[model samples]
Target: MTMSLGPYASFIVTSYAAAAIVVAILIGWVVLDYRNQARRLRELDRSGVTRRSGRSAVDTP
Candidate 1:
């Protein structure tokens, strides 16, 4: 089946295409960032580094 966009076809089609591309780019960036962060955390862990929090486990008690 053939789909047709009436008078504002170009505008509508271009808008949808642009939106799709933007969403794809955003998803790719998030995945890349997550991988990089995970790798950095692993390296830090290997070097015996620990994360500190303002509220300590001992303080909680």
Candidate 2:
């Protein structure tokens, strides 16, 4: 059996393939960045570095 996408098939197929490639690249980049950031945070924490929150600041009387 054979499937066919009549006229404009080439253009349509190419567009879909391009979009898929772009999405895959974006997902991979995000995953890598998350892992790198997490590792850095862990290293910082071990070295006595702290992440300050806005509310942690002392208020002046």
Candidate 3:
């Protein structure tokens, strides 16, 4: 059997691909961020991070 696209099939395919790529990127970002946050939380728990006032990372004038 021969399958055929009536019209705009190429556009539909591209759109689907783009949507999938976007979702994949978003999922990856979320996973990475969750991992980073978990690591930070672990470190904070180990070190007992407190809310002490100190010089910030960068010098601000």
Candidate 4:
């Protein structure tokens, strides 16, 4: 079986590929940022720095 994209096959395929690449990059960036932030919070906690509520930075509730 085969599918056709008419006269704009290359354009359509390129657009989809570009979108996928952008989404992948964004996801990677978010994951790295989250890890970096968590590490920073841990360091702060070790140094006795904490929230104004006197709770650990890594703590939830």
Candidate 5:
């Protein structure tokens, strides 16, 4: 079987590609930010800072 995108094929394809690119960028940004925040928290913990709950930032539980 075969399908057609009609006259607006290029526009449709471009729109989909742009959306995918945007989503990929956002995901990458989130992952990098998470790693940075984790590192900062570890630093604070090492300096003797603790959360309000009295738990160390690096504590697992």
Candidate 6:
């Protein structure tokens, strides 16, 4: 049931919807990246990989 929107109402609705979609995409990307990074760190720790040859943790960071 699509009804006619008053003049400029359609524009406002479109703009708000576009803004919402962009914000949602940005938030999802950030969350996914964070999770992936955390998972990688855990895996590295569990693998018994300690100390880089001739390189300190400070150097890696």
Q: Give the CA lDDT, 0 to 100, for residue 33 in model 1.
A: 100
Scanning candidate 2 in windows of ten residues, the lowest lDDT window is 52-61
**Candidate 1, 1-61: lDDT as tens digits:** 9888899999999999999999999999999999999999999999998787756888776
The models' CA-based lDDT, in order, is 0.94, 0.89, 0.86, 0.94, 0.94, 0.89
Better of 1 and 3 by TM-score: 1
TM-score of 5: 0.82
Residue pairs with clashing backbones, model 2: none
Give a tens-digit lDDT track for model 3, residues 15-58.
99999999999999999999999999799879988544555657
Residue 57 error for model 3, in Å?
32
lDDT for position 46 in model 3: 91
lDDT of 2 by residue, 1-61 (tens): 8879889899999999999999999999999999999999999999998766534457433
Q: Write the per-residue lDDT of candidate 4 for residues 25-57, one digit (tens) a residue.
A: 999999999999999999999999968786667
Q: Lowest summed-lDDT stretch of 10 residues in model 6?
A: 48-57
Q: Which ten residues in a row have the lowest lDDT in candidate 5?
A: 52-61
TM-scores for the candidates: 0.81, 0.80, 0.71, 0.82, 0.82, 0.64
In angstroms, give how far residue 52 of model 3 lies from its true place. 13
Better of 3 and 5 by TM-score: 5
lDDT of each residue in 8-27, candidate 6, tens digit only: 89898999999999999999
Root-mean-square deviation of every model: 2.9, 2.9, 6.9, 5.4, 5.8, 6.4
For candidate 1, give the lDDT: 0.94
In angstroms, how far off is 19's CA in candidate 6? 0.4
